[model samples]
Target: MSESNSAGMFSGRKSEGLVLVVDDEPDVRKVVRMTLEKSGYTVLEAEDGEKAIAEMKKDENSLLLSLIITDIRMPNMNGIDVINYYRKEWPSVPLIVLTGFPDMDMATSMLQHGIADYLVKPVEAEKLRSSVSKTLEKREVHGF
Candidate 1:
């Protein structure tokens, strides 16, 4: 994404909220970051839940996060733990889960745990953008 395009995405907005994207795959993270950055959000990436948690903690003073997008499976720590931690510590921030497994039980569990949306792996660009837009819109409307 061009700097001009990214800047234009939030030029008239009051705030261009930061988004955290977590996944073990570098390719996935790159695509996600590009997608979100093109849409005007500042994106942070972490390779695993531990790194994600550290990123969150490091930004505690800033607290500019508007959303989190994470993959379900990872080494060291999984997305479930990350989601649970954020749900408790930063309940106001919305979360979206991206997983390859797509098990019914896991989906149900994620929803029950306060995820704003769930997406399957190999996500299309349009789908990712749509999901993100809708989720962020909901957060804005509800004053989350």
Candidate 2:
């Protein structure tokens, strides 16, 4: 890991890029925030996809969203629709989808559509950080 990444992982939250955590479950949101914040990312919470969209829109500098971790199944809107809208509106925001489903075909389709990464439910802290860091690196390379 680079020095910056090491600092992010261990030195505790010096960096301040906003990360949106979208899940219907309160516990998931709480844990995700705790994990990412501990790793140096500022986290924002939204219960469902609709609220997530609203939060993104309410902020003027939506491009600063370092990452969006969204669950696939939600009440008002789903992850797929959220992905579609983000692609249309805020393409700069890197998305990491979380889902309970393990269908390879659906995962393949989501990958093709522009998600930075995907995670299965009950994400480990290391796995989540790894994906977040990987996506951030991709953003740096792609000129986000």
Candidate 3:
């Protein structure tokens, strides 16, 4: 609502932070970007894991990234590959999984591995916003 908009724009804390959304589907990326942007987050998009990795390699992007939202299935390197890279190289950065296909076992494992959240796709705007906010806040509290 208007309150959320103002908090994003006029709050003393500034923006929530930069969020990278990795998904193969353009529509998915667009929706996710719009949602996060509205919540006062700067969003970057990557069509696949390779591009996400490329983005992460940059000192500018990687240093400012508060969270990463990615789909489990993607062409070229999958989300698993991205998550592995993140765990090995940047475990302090929190991650969220948004996918149409859900595997409970995989989800459980990912949660155990410290992923922030695993959300089924077509995520409600409010839910996505809340999750992103909470994840970013959690990262902030952890000093990451």
Ranking by TM-score: 3, 2, 1
lDDT by residue (tens digit), candidate 1, 59-103: 242267778898877655565776876677677888899888768
Per-model TM values vs. the true structure: 0.79, 0.81, 0.82
Name model 3 segments beyond 4 Å from true: 1-13, 76-79
- Candidate 2: C-alpha RMSD after superposition: 6.0
Full-model lDDT for every candidate: 0.76, 0.75, 0.77
**Clashes by residue pair, model 2:** 13-40
lDDT of candidate model 3 versus the reference: 0.77
State in Å the error of residue 56, model 1: 3.0
Error of 1 at 11 (Å): 9.3
Better of 1 and 3 by TM-score: 3
Compared with the true structure, what per-residue lDDT tens digits does model 3 show for residues 1-144? Answer: 222211123345476687888888988988987887787787777887778778766656777778889888854555567678667766788889998966798889888877999999878999999998888878778786
Q: Relative to the unseen true structure, what is the C-alpha lDDT of residue 45 in candidate 2, on a scale of 0 to 100?
A: 77
